[model samples]
Target: KSLTSAGRTVLNLALVVISSVAAIGAINLSTRESSDSSTFLLTADVVAPTLTLSNSYERRDGIVLGEGFYNDWGHLAEIHRSTRVEASTTVDDCLYGWTKVDTYGTETFTGYGDQVEMIFESVGWNGISLLIKCPSTEQTATYPVMVKYVRREIRLLNESDRSTFFDTLYTTYTTEQVDGERAYGKKFRSIKRLVSEHLLGAADKECDHWHDDAGIMTHHIAFTLEMEQSLQSIDKTVTIPYWDYTQDAYELDDWTDSDIFNPAWFGMASPSSKDHVITEGRWAYMSVGKQADTDGVRNPYGLLRSPWNTNPTPYILRHRYVYDEKDGGWTLPGCTDFSSAWSYNSLGEYFDELNGELHGPVHIMIGGQWWVNRTMNFSATNGGDFLLASKFLWRQGYVRCPELCSDDTPDDRCTCSCPDELTRYFRTSRDFLDQTGLFNLSDGLFSDWSNFATTGCMTPDDCFDTVVKALCHVGHAGEMFTSAAPYDPTFWPIHGLADRYLSLKRIQAHENETILSQMWSYSHDGNSPSDTRRVCDWSKVGDTMGLPDCYVGDCAGHRAQDLLPMGNFLDRNESYTNEEFYKFMNPRNEELPYIYDSFTQWPACTDQAICWWNTDGAC
Candidate 1:
């Protein structure tokens, strides 16, 4: 009674033929009997509908999470035509149903349509299914999609992304976590703890561990990653948005007028009250726990010697430039400066220029010269003496000499000139005085005006040492001026700019086929012999480097292989070596989870002919 294989195929074909004939006959009969008979019948088509994706979105690998795709309905559409067709009818015109099944296995009935948009609220693989229905049967097709995380410029973030970023940052800043069991289980890991780590690394007097060395880029890169990772723990969808100050420096006449200082952004550049506390912005009314003493020093772990009272002050202080064109002495580097900085082929020279010229300037401009109880004036003195005394002040835009102006005055409006060596003296003196409080009037270099006049320090090095030693004793500066600069929120974004520059440099170096490991060595002489120093030789890995006395960790030598001394402050079980930190300096590194948006407005490299790594001076 069983049928053979060929016979079964033949019988099925005959059955299909008979079904088609019956369907036609039923249709004809229904059409003829519709007037008097309420009952009418037609054979249902056995063929099922087919579903497929439209060509538009099929080529894309994925989309960024949190940024949902619009017009996605057009991307998923029914493409199959019915096998059963009439003179004017086809399955193409039939309505289709759409349903979305997410990664959680939750199904949602989108609607009855040939096209339906797909959206995912979470990151990773998401599934969307489409169902098409013909007269009798239905067909379903599923598409798998990927969603990823991307760090965008603060300005480019959508409303949802912006909210999430701020929310996570605020939450991390406010929440307290246990640091250690010592001192009654004292808590940490708030914004204060994060800033304290920066202070510990940068303010330590025994070692120049973080700044002014080859490790500057890598150390700060690791530091920033820690801060970002802390925020991401609360919400994995959030990424820290970078502030590209170069855009403001180039596009705006006055960089302070940038919208980044708006209330919705970082905050106003200048505080509205005398306390120097920011009153507007996402970080408005925020208070920090650390305080600087009159000596411009802070205890990395304990209560600070408060400037006003005996109690530690819990306030974030900023002395940013007032929002007026007249306050024009301090400024962010222009596009031309950035262009020149980007052209350096040697990592050492590039790091030196960037740290001194770009990074240091932002800190100075933001924190300002610390609050001085007294501002000395030599205007009442003779013109010659005034010119001599004002040389440093005038060049820094802190003072203007109207009496020295001539009919043919230069564009800067004053024609008085000082020796280039003295100018270097002033530059060194400003930085030395601001950073280290080691200067004193007893040095006899500037104890008296007559002594300054008779000092015959016309050469650069002698004048620099003499002036720096003299000024360091006289003035103390604000947060940004010292190693405790992280008390201000502006410090983060300013350092973000530094990180961005490193990313740019790494990209260019890779393009040129340069060896990254070879570029880690740098030699730097301290401002003074007593100042902290770092002279790294990449080839000499055995050489040891000193760490601060406050540091209780293992030794960190002056080589790329040594561990960063302050890595423990991030509360990680394992510390990162300089080489390990260096690997992630480039934003494009696979291990780095986030990427910076394009620096579309930054200047192009102009010194193409100069090869920085070429010792023989050959291009």
Candidate 2:
């Protein structure tokens, strides 16, 4: 529809373009229309805005709500995004006139430019709308439009373990509805667990999705709360605690040499470090359900971690723990500046990179088995440097793939509508792609925030490639048990830190925190594995794939209003899908289960740190 990029690049070996901006390849990123995309031309030094317009009357799919945001500021000094939606008329045909929709999300200036947004829904607009602006000073221009990706807001889990899980969770219940019974909310963990069970029990398991339910990457949080609830039910005083590995002094002698290894916390030595069962704590006594293992068997093994079991934070990624005394900030093993990383043209193309670098490391370093962590690099195939795609595809049984990178490989194909925030990381002409694979890349540019921002001088080079790879290296346990990595209690705390980091980035990047919308692909390849699915077909993490109709589990072919219920194995017939279930549909509003420890004023390892850049002071 718009001028596609990623083509006609000036070839260069040192630098490569994964995909053309035209979005011609398998990677699909039509998520959000560039809010600043216009048909007008700009004079040398002018900054203007472009907008996508629509009205409340233009109801197409379910309802018509549009979102606009300016996430990239690479070019002009002062850039803005503006939209004017008309009911029966156009921005130009004032003869019919139009009204403005007030759904502006949030705006911020990230050195590059101003990021502005508005979340619109069915009632937000009245009629068909048109975008009316250009990159520079020009007459009003009108263009066609569509879309929004509001982040999903999850109410923070009760740190006290008082049980406020489902109140605003899947189901929105007011105080009156809650009836003052906190246990009612806490008990919903069973439903959440039920969903996880359905996901894990699938004949052809998509363990990654189940282990981490492909939404805002919050499934792990859900798991943490469920486990905490279960444990608290027993001790009433046991609340899941977090391990802040990024701090300066741990009072326990830092991360690597801390008491986390003590049986009182997380037992270090097991009869076999290979099956490094935490011999102490409630986790030791707790028996787990059937894992996404070979026999779907309840083997009753202890928590298994890698060599650094005596302590936490494996040497493989220990350097990342270096503390920046300047402001008490430390490095995240494979952390990316969520503010700007991969928010571009094809989120799917780069999805695996994030997994390989960031999420993958936790599982590998912590879980010592699976022969996965041993390798530093990975290939799209099954038996590459690590067990990436195959593990995800192994489904409920940890089945291995013979070798093929297709639908079976959950590392790709999430349906997304990207925003102009992508513009900051990409420029049309570059020589970054190789025929070895379409958009397939070997990441690793984020040595640290400082190194990433300094490497690329031109192109969107400094934008996407430079920063997104700030992830921990991938290896075994994470690779092998990637599906249900959460079975290991340690998974919760690591994810907690990661989640906190993401929230920190969001708070640092924009003023608005409301998640416009989130989508996950419900499509799964039949029983066995296949290579037919392209890079765009994989839904790594929680990406939603397919177009008009895509869902997580048994909730397929359902409408937003009618789709209120928990996920359950159809074979078990334990799922609830009726008016009674309507109370549980994801409300996507401002309710959260946990709040991140604030670090808005933390020191900067580099300029990428928003607070440091804005205040001119690291503290």
Off by over 4 Å in 2: 1-203, 206-218, 225-240, 248-255, 269-275, 279-356, 370-385, 389-480, 508-590, 597-617
Q: 80-186, model 2: which lDDT tens digit per residue?
A: 12323222222331122122222132122111112223232311101111222233322321111122222111212232232332222212111222232355443
Residue-level lDDT tens digits of model 1 in 112-160: 6544444444332333444444434444444433232344557666677
lDDT against the true structure, per candidate, is 0.45, 0.28
Q: Residue 345's C-alpha lDDT in candidate 2?
A: 23
Q: Alpha-carbon error at 502 in model 1, in Å?
A: 2.8
Q: How close is candidate 2 to the true structure, as a TM-score?
A: 0.36
Model 2: ten consecutive residues of lowest lDDT: 71-80
User: Can you tell me which runs of candidate 1 are displaced by over 4 Å?
Assistant: 1-148, 179-188, 279-285, 290-313, 321-330, 373-476, 513-518, 523-558, 565-575, 599-619
In candidate 1, where is summed lDDT lowest over 10 consecutive residues? Answer: 78-87
